[model samples]
Target: MTNKKIAVVISSIFIFIMVISCSTSNDNPSETPVIPAVLNTVGLIRNDAGALNDGYVLFAPIGSNTTYLIDKCGKQVKTWASSYKPGQSCYLLSDGSLLRPGNTNNTTFNAGGKGGIIEKIDWNGNVTWSYTISDALQCQHHDVKALPNGNILVIAWESKTNTEAIAQGRNPNLVPTTVWSEQIIEIKPTGTSGGTIVWEWHLWDHLVQDFDASKANFNTVASSSKLININYNASATNQDWIHLNSIDYNASLDQILVSSHSFNEVWIIDHSTTTAQAKSHAGGNSGNGGDLLYRWGNSLAYNTGTTTQLFGQHNAYWIESGFPFENQIMIFNNGNGRTGGNYSTIEIIKPPVSGYNYTQTLPYLPATTSWNYNYGNPNSLYAQNISGAQQLSNGNVLFCNGPAGIFTEINSSGTTVWQYINPVSTSGVLKQGVTAAQNSVFRSTFYPKTYSGFTGHTLISGSTIEDVNLISTSCK
Candidate 1:
């Protein structure tokens, strides 16, 4: 699922709720429709018969508020709830639910039973189960992920007590500065006491304020204004350093790999350990910017001049098993460098030394093999952030564009095999999980009342042939 760009002070979940219904796009003057012409690589994709370019892809438009499960031809199989505050994340589950965080027009949402619950719905949009995480407890972010063990994972922020919050860098002067701590939560499955906390990880505990003030490498003005210390809430803190934004599980290793937008590092949480199994973190510590096991890109080495790196957050995934290039890790560097960088593209990297026992420094993304998409204007597609790189069955990369609201299938020579844009209705694409419709859109961000749309989804296999037709889908 895609993550929204929040400045990091407000509870992310609150921001998640806020953006869904934001009419900011109204402020964006409509520009001429730029029909996607073939990039130089389009010719190569035309020849790659394997790229999946069949059927239709549907999405919830940013302001439309309705989830339209459509076909490649733009036929809407279903449309639901013309009311969900339009946001950028949503997911399809095994139980036929469209998962997404939503906002309510009513300020008293929970009492009205119209907002804040992780609602599961049927194809008809009937609520099956709604898990209302206490808003006071969480500032939810861009997406929600379901765990294989029967729970869900959220990129949420936990509020701190007034006193304890102050020590963690909060400015007492700012009344409602909740002192948000970015975290990963594993919600227990049903049949248990509400839900069990399988595991949890917090960012503040492991940070080191090593950003040398003398050499602060920021482009923004040296604001003469007294900055808030929760600046742990600062952009780089959210982009290259600490707050973990995206997560994926390696069920094989019983480990979790998380992408910290602020720290620009990916970590593997070994769940095999029976210890509290919650909140403990290893690897790059926010202190001293020490590399936990291995580190690529940049770190908090301000003294060395190689300060904060990997500008912002995106996808860092392991090569799925059974692929031609198995075992190698693939990451999509969305190019919002923490401080600054040149190109924005997908980079497929291999470990300098590949084996078992993946460590922090295992796969160093090549400074070169990385691919960038320059949409003509020397500096175009200004907001091309957040991309997911998948090693497709056809050996192509199914690249999702978070800002431009498009997904493209590209071949090795950096060519676009096939492409689809998010309808003005749908804006960003996040961590896509399981897609059914051929040339389908898989979203990891699932919320309640999501079953509003979703009639029958078509299934496409390798961008070449039509595969299975799922009658009715369900989630556990």
Candidate 2:
């Protein structure tokens, strides 16, 4: 054979081998597309093979009046409009309605998470029910929970004058001019603009303090584990004393979980008690009435331990019945003043429970978390305030870094599988490539495609909410 012919045959053989290799690589499902490391790109950032692909994310930005539902591809599937900005949190109910709180900008309860109204907007954008709890001395704020029986539980701040605070055994020096306490109200929607408070629990009634012996509720602070110590937060001059940021209900247990940002603890109270029984310390299923059945995170709040486990935590709730760590409590442990440095962690703990009451322990139970997740370098997940975590059905965890408006989903092994950044900001929807600023979201929720809420609704995917799109199409 001629030397030229031999050389041409060798070249052809090499080209054919290269083409086959490329085709095989393309067919492999494990291969992930090369996502550009864009500095400030919004929408979907990462969507790997392990991420749950058949679910949508729901979020309401704190600065905007619009709540959104986006698919795994970061495309808008649905949206609900509100007249006022989010008080802080929103949720998509199973009945194709948006349950959200509207920030009425109440001057009386002029503090963070100041929401005065709760609205139930149907799938077609009509306000079917509206209720307001903001008044001179009390205003609903932060989070709300929709119960299985159609009633809504709201967190509100009730104010007390310094004279009233002093009369209640509060330290005169520690009391602000107006001391703000917390309460939970159960509202049954009576009509389009009316709600009847069927049941309520007042924190003011379950207080104990060692500051004043002459006062009626005075007692040894540490021993009164079931009661709140009015003087625990010595440095708190602000009227917003017990800033309860989140609330959750466990139908099976008939209990309520509330996260107190000020005391840095999650407290569970028996909801089986009537309004009359709740005012006293006895006569509930747990025989503890409205008193705390279980409280964890900060042992020092009740003066049981020297150190604390939670720091400015948010979104403390029980894992649903069928999830991986079912019935366990999960918290977004926002490490605001963590010992080493500021960082964040998602922790799940098995509370020591005996029927309706927690097994009485010095500092609660489960000395440490049953499971926890953080970046190898923990600071990567830090969100100083307003964040949340949810346990999905497939054993994966979805969480939001609220202040930065970032969402991440990690598998049981703590490997990040999916991520997205909020495109909506205070001004409006931001352009794709712009740095995400002022786009803080209170929280984000993951709903499976089979969610009952989407049953009859048309969830056609539209373009990204942001003005321009750069990454989602290519990356996905």
Candidate 3:
């Protein structure tokens, strides 16, 4: 009851309360830091549990001439320098070389995804071999695939004059001044900088159009689904008609898959055909020569379906053997004009194959996607163009929201486990806390540590591409 006794009791209660409060704060820290209204941090953003850590990501910034290989922690492992910026895909080859398309700035075939040269550079930055496909009449662009036999498959724009287009049954009213048709050329590398075109397939050769009955290639549009309808998306001013943005080769079946951006379709053609046979409707293993053996996405392109499944999509390719969903195609559905509202999704479809040929169906088989991923909030993943997705060995999906220069990896359950933002912009490396801009990446590819390309090379990890500060110390 004394004054001293009362003071001691009050002091003990105060100390006990303070101790409990400190313990609670220390035990239950915030699960995730509050993100800024505008994200300014670059490089590795997240590397949560469940991410495939035994891999490196390879990416070519659209604004830079350098291709980078970085670890999951955002440490640079290696880089390949080029004289020209990416035209815009790059790949690390099994023999410790970089294969990339360079934007030689071809004025004649000036369009998106324009690449006039393909270069193979050794790990030590030596240009081992280079091939030029740029010219007035035709120019290589977009993607290329290295064949198992040391050859290359290239996608190019083959120009056709208005007269030439109309002669092939293109509607006169829709014919452009110059129609940039597409072609796939298989190049046999003879020596450094020298390549022989051993085989080529032209889109012009397998055309069918209902616009002009008098034309030699005229046929019912829906019935001749095997052939490209020359008038489907023809425009009076848009010369880049069949804008094929990606090319993938399936070695087992000897077929090539190409994504037609303008048509909103993914098509497969027989690669086993000879040049002569490819120019006709008969001769390849499928007995259809270079005619499209399988086509999907927008069945409306062939007048077979009412709903269009893909909108301005990109990076359509077959899931490689030995990986989950092998042989199925995975696409970055860009969702440019998606009906419900623009949103992006990584989609996979199992094409019904019957020994090198797709099942004969009105709108192609596998009517819906077997698997697809979008952020719980779909809009969070939207990218209007130039994005890509791939299934990693651990069943995680790696993708790039190209326009945002953001790369994300999600596990099989659609949970984000890893993420990174490209730090190099058109002006070079950005500083942390500086809003990332002009740093778009066409795509980012995941190469497992066991990749043959990393063999015999010492991969020394270096600092992140961007300048870091205290705010990003946790990432370090």
Candidate 4:
């Protein structure tokens, strides 16, 4: 689908997609989509990329529980809606399947949160394999990456001996009320007994300071004998409060790169290529520390925070297998509310040499730092300052003005070549003259070098796609 055609389809959906009426608010079903999946597009399109020749876009639309798969031109292709609230790490496999982490909370999860499930979805949206951590302690905030040998690597939060710690009287000093262990595990599909764990890592054995105590959000840490930390506890574990949101393994470097969103840094686990996970097994004891190595995002000799490392972003890691910069780290800098520097941006940076390296020679899509926002009053559903950015093969950028549900395509020089808007609303909330309409985007993501599909058929392909082919036999 061409950008123009995609725009028309989005407009049509907006024109017919009914808005909920307030008169029926009381009678409205309790299950209105909390993550409504309406979508749109933005930015200049691309064509052939050096290494990233073709790929799809993956995103969590508002309302829907599934992870959507759209074609190169913004055409709805497939979906993996396995959980109510899908986690941040979802990788599209080479076979067109998807790998994602999910969880279920004992108490009520937020309106859109639910059970946890590590899943492998086939192209037909079928669950080829699934593992649900027992109901006692739920695993949230996880990341997954597929290895060359078909094994999957994961970074997750595991229920620690905290309850056991309190029972044993060995709780660390100044620990938050909520405590849990952050972990990394590798799963290999064994034709018969599901996937087997090949390697694993944890956050406990490596901490030397009161890191979790600094994270002070989310009750993942604890000071009481309570089985778990208060849901209000700021940091969960890792005194640094390392909220590991995304993980990527570089086979070339035999290294594991983790995006610790909350802690404001990335962690690298370096293992020599000569011994790339040679003798590793998952689900091992946390006391052993030889099987792993570590480096801080900005403190190491090679990482100098050159491009201003991300602050609270989601899914920052290597591109897909066939992507142009397959090994480079591309981040969806969600710009989740606060950035000491620029308001929001999507950054694609080359991996650092060792640690403590820095550079600004990367491509950046900057959000409109200042944009007025007034719902209804002539500007209802008005654009806000929040924005999204993705890197294309040819160095152009795909930018999403998240606040107003607006998306635009830009060239390498920062030009809007294409655009889109999301119009998702609640079931019974009418918007006559309000100041914050219910239709917009929480976030967006594009496939490496490929035009990640958008809602309906609003595509943001590269400038190479001069015109979108909406009526092509491609959809048939």
Instruction: Tell me the lDDT of candidate 4.
Output: 0.45
lDDT of candidate 1 over 270-300, digit per residue (tens): 5444334233332222211211223344433
lDDT of 4 by residue, 200-288 (tens): 65554333212344442222222111111222223334332445666777776566777666554555554332222323321212211
Model 1 lowest lDDT segment of ten: 467-476
Instruction: Tell me each candidate's TM-score.
Output: 0.60, 0.92, 0.91, 0.57
RMSD of 2: 5.3
Give per-residue CA lDDT, model 3, range 1-476, as digits (tens). Answer: 99999999999999776544432412222233222223337887776767787879999999999999998877788989999999889999999999999999999998889999999999999999999999999999989999999899999999999999989988889987899999999999878899999999999998998888898888888998999998888789999988999999999899999999999889999989999999998888898898999998888888887988888999999998888999899999898888888888889999999997888888887888899887344547789999999999889999999999999999999988888899999999998888889999999999988999999999977777887632231222
Q: What is the lDDT of residue 426 in candidate 1?
A: 30
How many pairs collide in each candidate, listed in order?
Answer: 53, 0, 0, 73
RMSD of 1: 16.2
Residue 94 in candidate 3, Cα distance off native in Å: 0.6
Segments in model 4 whose C-alpha atoms lie over 4 Å from true places:
1-55, 71-73, 80-83, 106-115, 138-140, 161-173, 190-193, 210-240, 271-309, 319-326, 334-342, 351-390, 399-408, 422-476
State the C-alpha lDDT per candidate. 0.44, 0.88, 0.87, 0.45
Per TM-score, the best of the predicted structures is 2
Where model 3 places Cα greater than 4 Å from the true spot, the runs are 1-40, 375-379, 469-476
